[model samples]
Target: MNLARGSSDDSGSLLWGLGAIALYALISYGLDYRARARRGSRHPAREALHDLKDREEPQSPRHRIVSRVIMIGGGVLTGLVAYTTSGTLRAVAAGLTAVVAVTAWAYYDHRTETRDSAG
Candidate 1:
């Protein structure tokens, strides 16, 4: 599929869209893993950054669900903007933006089991 031309087929574009979402998810997961694995390092600056990525702020289960919902909404909004305003190039940029934004947000906000919530 030639994404440069912005494939005329809706099916092709839909697949690309789903692929973008999955890519973002994978990046976010990797960042979380990296932060956790390197958390014990003695470097202060790196530790501080990783701590944020490790979700230093305690979040309830409800907060986690809401954050995920909002992140999905953001991706959908940016994807629509990129597709409508430009072509495949902009769409690719949108995917990159989503990856970074989602990864950073996931660093501070994450999924927690409802059963673990004190409420």
Candidate 2:
């Protein structure tokens, strides 16, 4: 499928992609709702909209490792999807962007950890 050309064949794939996204969103929402219910949160919408503050407890090293692994895996998956759907160039760009983002996040996390430990 040549995505560069506005071909009718692309429309079916686009619709399927959109449907998949919608289904995933719905499932995510349901899970969040269940979690909120379990927590006895009255204002689910407000809680969802609220920015995540730093946790009172520090994350364990294992947790940090798992989080980083998941982040990198997500990036790789995104790059692969872009490669299959768009092209090599787009995949390369996406992969690079993901790497930069992950690097920045890791640096920020390290700085925060050091600052917390010092003070």
Candidate 3:
């Protein structure tokens, strides 16, 4: 008996799943943003262990806005690709690719800021 069945029209489920993942990611990001903002980026672990405030500061508004835009755009791209392709795997792959691209962009931006600060 072989049970490797797959549907070509699983776009509905794929879109739903992608939306759920994006929603989860957005919530996580928002919570992290708020927590870090409130805590002021100081290493809580070190503060607990050595009683020191974090010298590093919270990210700026521009950074937060850009990150949020990436997440939203990724979600939209995932949905659109899924709708157009009508294939579960392809849609998922597209969504993942979008997320990776957004993350890489953010990382590059962050590295540039770090380099600018150092130099």
Which portions of model 2 miss their true places by more than 4 Å? 1-10, 49-119
Worst 10 residues of 2 by lDDT: 48-57
| Model 2 TM-score (2 dp) | 0.36
- In candidate 2, how many Å is residue 18 off? 1.8
- C-alpha displacement of 64 in model 2, angstroms? 8.0
Each prediction's Cα lDDT score? 0.58, 0.48, 0.53
Tens-place lDDT digits, model 2, residues 4-118: 5445444444544344334333433444455456779997645533312223234456545554565445455444444335445544554555555455545555565566577
User: How do the residues 8-117 of candidate 1 rate in per-residue lDDT, one tens digit apiece?
Assistant: 54445555556566666566556655655676655545554555353554566566666667667756755554544345675677676776677656644643433345
Of the two candidates 2 and 3, the one with more favorable TM-score, higher being better, is 3
Residue 92, candidate 2: alpha-carbon lDDT: 59
Which one is best on TM-score? 1
Deviation in Å, model 2, residue 91 alpha carbon: 26
- How far residue 74's Cα lies from its native spot in candidate 3, in Å, is 1.5
**Model 3 stretches astray by more than 4 angstroms:** 1-57, 92-96, 105-109, 112-119
Task: State every prediction's TM-score relative to the real structure.
Answer: 0.51, 0.36, 0.43
lDDT of 2: 0.48
Quick one: ranking by TM-score, best first? Answer: 1, 3, 2
